[model samples]
Target: MVSIAQGTFRTVLLTPEGRLLDCRASSVLLPSHDGMIGILRNHAPMLCELQKGIIQVKNIPDRKNAYYLIDGGFARISLNHLTILAYEVITFEGMDREQAERTAALAKESVATKGSFVSNFDEEIDPDRAAFIVKLAHLSEIGND
Candidate 1:
C-alpha cells in the first residue's frame, strides 16, 4: 500500500439543497458503500457510491478538521480534485456543543420510537438508516466540541 501524507487537493461537498463544504484538504476520508475510503492528492481517478456516515476532511489550511454527516451520495475523484454529491447533509456549522448534544438526544429518541412503532406490516424502521442517524449524532457532538 502506498502512503499519502503530503500535498493538497480541492474538495467540494454538495447536496441538492446547496453546497455544504468547499475547501482544500490534505486528505479526506469518506464512507463508501463498501467501507471507508481515503483520498489524497494525485490519487487515481475513481468513482463510487457513498454510504450514510461521516465525512472527515483533514489538514485544512485555515480551520480545524471538519466533519459532515451524509445520508447517501456519489464521489468523483480526478486530477487531485474530489467532488462529493450527497443526498442529504447534516452539519454542525456554528452549532454549540449543547445544541449538538440535544440533537443527538433527539436522534436517539427518534430511533427508539421508530423501532418500537410497528405500524403497517410492510413498513418498519430501517436498521441501517437508524444506525446512520445515531452515528451522525455522535459525530456532530464531537465536531461541535
Candidate 2:
C-alpha cells in the first residue's frame, strides 16, 4: 500500500539543450504518443513515447506549479522518479512578466494570423503549436498579466 508520505515524486524534464526542471511534484500529466497519462508517486516503472503537448507538474513544494510545451520525445518512470526527455521544451518558469506576455501575444497572433511565428529561440511555431502554447500559457497563468 502507498503511504501518505509517498504522495510526491521527483520529476525531471530535459531537452537536448539541457535540464529544465528538477523538482518534487504531487502529480504529473504527460502526453503519451497514444494519449494522456497521469502519474503519481509509486507508479509502476515504464517507458513511453511522448507527443507534442503540455506537461503539467502540480503541487510543487515552495514553487509555483509548472507547465511545459514539449515536442515529441520519451518519458521514463521508475523508483519514484519521472524523467522526460524531449527534443524541445518551452515554459515560462524563468521568464519575467514582460517576456511571458510577449510570448503569449506572439502565440495568439500566430494562431489568429494562421501563419508560422518564430520564437525567441528561433524555432518556428505553426498555428497548431502556437495554439497549444497559448493554452499552456493560460494554464500556467504566466501570461495572464
Candidate 3:
C-alpha cells in the first residue's frame, strides 16, 4: 500500500447557469482581476473578483488537472475551500468540439475584418472578455476539425 503525500480537497466551480465543475484537487490557479492566484492545501481565507481568463486545478487524487475559461465574476477561498462564482465558464473538457470551432471561427472572422483585434481598444464591450474569448477560440483551433 502507498500513502499519498497529501489528501485531496474538494473543489466546486459553479455558475448561475449550472454546475460547471465539482471535484477534488490539491491545488488550483485562478486568473483574478489583479493577476493569477494560486490556491493550495489549507490556504488562507480570501475573496476575489474574477476576470475573463482561465482557472486551473492541479493534482486531484482521483481527478485530472482541470482548465476552464471563465467570464468575469467572483471567487472565494478559505481554509481548504475554494469556490468560484462566474457568470460564464467554458471548460475545455466540457466544450463540444464542433461548437468551439464555430465560436473560434466567428471571432477570427471578426478580428480579421478589424485587422488585429485591437486588444487595447475600449468599447461598450469589455476588451478583456473579448480577449479571453479569442484565447478560447485559439485553443479550439488546436486539432479543431
TM-scores, all candidates, are 0.76, 0.92, 0.69
* Candidate 3's TM-score: 0.69
Clashing pairs in 3: none
lDDT, candidate 2, 23-112, per-residue tens:
999999999999999998889999999999999999999988899999899999999999999987888788787878888999999999
Which of the predicted structures, 1 or 2, would earn the higher lDDT when compared with the native? 2
Tell me, what's the RMSD of every candidate?
5.5, 1.9, 5.5
lDDT of 3 by residue, 41-75 (tens): 77768899988787877886765567777767888
Which candidate leads the pack in TM-score?
2
TM-score of the candidate numbered 1? 0.76
Clashes per candidate, residues 3 or more apart or on different chains: 0, 0, 0
lDDT of each: 0.75, 0.90, 0.67
Per-residue C-alpha lDDT of model 1 across residues 1-145, encoded as one tens digit per residue: 5556478999999899888889999999999999999998889999999988889888999887788877789999999889999975766666676666665555566577665322122233354555554676565445334
Evaluated against the true structure, the overall lDDT of model 3 is: 0.67
Better of 2 and 3 by lDDT: 2
Q: How many backbone clashes does candidate 3 have?
A: 0
Which pairs, if any, clash in model 2?
A: none
